[model samples]
Target: MKSGWMRGIIILLVFVLGLSIGYFLPDRKEKMDVPVASVGDEIITELMWLNQLKEDYGEQVLQDMIDRKVVFSEANRLGITVSDKEIEQEIQKMRKAYENDEQFLNSLKEQSGTTLEQLKEDMRYYLTWEKLATKDVVVSDPEIEEYYNNNLYLFQEPEKVHAWQIVVSTEEEAKQVIRELEEGTDFSTLAKERSMDLLTANQGGDLGFISLNDSYFDPSFLEVAFSLKEGEISSPIPVEKGFVILKVTEKVKERIIPLDEVKDTIRKEIALSQVPSLPQVLDQLRKQAKAQILINDNGK
Candidate 1:
């Protein structure tokens, strides 16, 4: 299952208990009378909103929750557990996509609308589900080695440089920036203070690892960026956005990742491929558990 498929599931579970915050009130009349909106002459109460939510998302959300519960129950019965360390490792793997921990967290919030703890809980559920689903599946050593040999290109890392830049609207401005860097001024500080690239300026122009094949970067920028040695700063290079001076902080030569580093990942991939899809696994689990739905569409 995709890591973020549970993004909005938790909030949807709230509908199972009550729709609005006022549902927790001590007085029955107040709970029923809580207004959700004003329709000019009419007031829409919490009950109305609750009914609407139930009508729209209630059945699918309940089924999702049921699937989660079934997995957890089966895992508990079988003593299959996902540890905090395992979850952290998975999170670290996911974190590789971002520049830093802060960037990852920020992107997680922006893209998934979830906090770290919520993400952890989601991971726990997903990992537990995987363990339960794939417990019977086996991947042999030969299979892993064969898969690795067949997909060697997938393991190759391209030549990349961890670089920072200071973009200015004028060539003279860029030249002065370089002069400051040549003297004693800090590159990151100068970037924050003067760089015009709004996306990276606030982050001290951190262009975390760019490869020559990265199509998003301008050809002129890549030409200058890739040519510079580590710790060496480029002269003002003209681009669509006036001038950009790059400093390569770190460099990595192209190489294939070792099989040992990716063996467990390969094993998991092979095992998962052999097992039923996640939804199918959940459906089977529900059957084994003899799960029953107590609610119906008619609210009977």
Candidate 2:
């Protein structure tokens, strides 16, 4: 579960309750006028469901709320703060892993049980605490070199190709272009004049370098690109939007990423890993602040 969260980048643990700012919501007695579920003559009302959820998970949710408050206050005391633009930038980078903003939100709802607003709020706190925790953290060059040597597999590169393309609406059109190429017509000239792909049409159909894992292009197109030898032009291959004629410009062998490029990332990992877990850090801060919780045993 922890690994899943790490991969998904979904950190909010508390679910549906995250959407609302207040944990202990006021009575919705008027809205409970209708039945949520009915069994013969008996009915479970909306208020009942809400009450059950609160009774079952309220304590944990309240604790999460407390931790958030503690972290934010501690950050403020230390004159540490994160701006909306920084948060948005991080969110945009993460969102690139998804198809679009809508899909990102849907994934969040399904995985972390949080909305966009709640995610922003939680992210601010998490960043605050992370900054506070790692303020004095240091990772040496030796440590980075050691980690890079031991974890070379993690940097292994996938197959990649550098290719050019001219996309057309029909296989016949693509084949006609291939024939033109065979008859000594320049691919880039024809691509600039007639290719239907707007983005690359003016650039002489240069798709640049791409790998199998690149989300921008179709897997089938990438497969055909990599299969072609350097300087070989492909037969028309059908894709989602249209048929494409490809020219293989270059081929790259799989290789590990260099250590110097990933030094900062490795340093962050080593530093954060050395510190107490976020929860533990928050607990320590709460203790320092002498924060208290009052639970009414009279069945709140």
Candidate 3:
């Protein structure tokens, strides 16, 4: 049986080791540690598990640790350091991608099965790498403009429509509802009275916004929705669920994200692109530090 403490440590190790070779510190003294668990009458010891892991992943794990150490040392020698503020900014930046704090933490657990602090440590190492790699990289105004021009689509927003829908069971019913919508019957009132969509029936059949990019509705339906002017109602559109009648409430016109607005981001992107990849940087560090590996896989 595994001791709870050792089991907890192993759980941490599963993720901690995934992000790092930093678990077993190089300076920590090795020991012929005693049993940390027992299976029925037989014993399962710390040394046994350690040796097992070593046999399976010792070389790769050892290399990761060595590489981490070299990266840290090289960054230190070059006076490259990341601050607490920078780390927090990165953390918050990541959180923005998630809908809420719970989602953010849940995603962290699912992806790495690790705590926030451990993820931060991993991020700190990543930031350190970025600093070391792009420390001397420079991108000029011309470079930014050229890259922006080449990737113009990346900087443009697609046309989108904020619309509502009344989904009914049959095409004739859909057409009947459309006639009501046109002949002075309120769209929202009809939607609440007749729309079969329980989700949006109460909200006046609101399907929310549909864009060329959003896949919420059928692509053909979205095509018709975007084509209509705001307040215009569509004819019955056949779809997988049922026939849908859409009323455009808001049409956000497509616009080019101005050059000034995205120039800084473009600059950093091109600069990072110029920097060597993480593995290549680690390889360079290995040569610079004259790192060597001699792990014994025999579990001796």
Per-candidate clash tally = 0, 0, 2
Write one digit per residue (lDDT tens) for candidate 3, span 15-73: 35532333465432233345678889888765566656666656665566676688889
Q: What shift in Å separates residue 269 of candidate 2 from its native position after superposition?
A: 1.4
Local lDDT at 181 for model 1: 92
Give the Å shift of residue 113 in candidate 2. 3.5
Poorest 10 consecutive residues of model 1 by lDDT? 1-10
Top model by lDDT, which number?
1
- Which candidate, 2 or 3, would have the higher TM-score against the true structure? 2
lDDT of 2: 0.75
Please tell me which predicted candidate would have the highest TM-score against the true structure.
Answer: 1
Assess each prediction's global lDDT (C-alpha) against the native: 0.83, 0.75, 0.73
Whichever of 1 and 3 has more lDDT, that candidate is 1
Candidate 1 structure quality by residue, lDDT tens digits, 1-300: 253355556546557457544445567546666787997889998778777777876776777678779999999999999999989989988886665566778887787777788788888989999888889888899999999999999999899999898889999999899889989999999999999986678789888888888787888788888999999999998888889989998999999999998998899889999999987988899999998789778756
Error of 2 at 136 (Å): 2.8
Error of 1 at 84 (Å): 2.8
What are the C-alpha RMSDs, in order, of all predicted structures? 3.0, 7.7, 9.4
Residue 262 alpha-carbon offset, candidate 3, angstroms:
4.3
- What lDDT score goes with residue 26 in model 3? 47
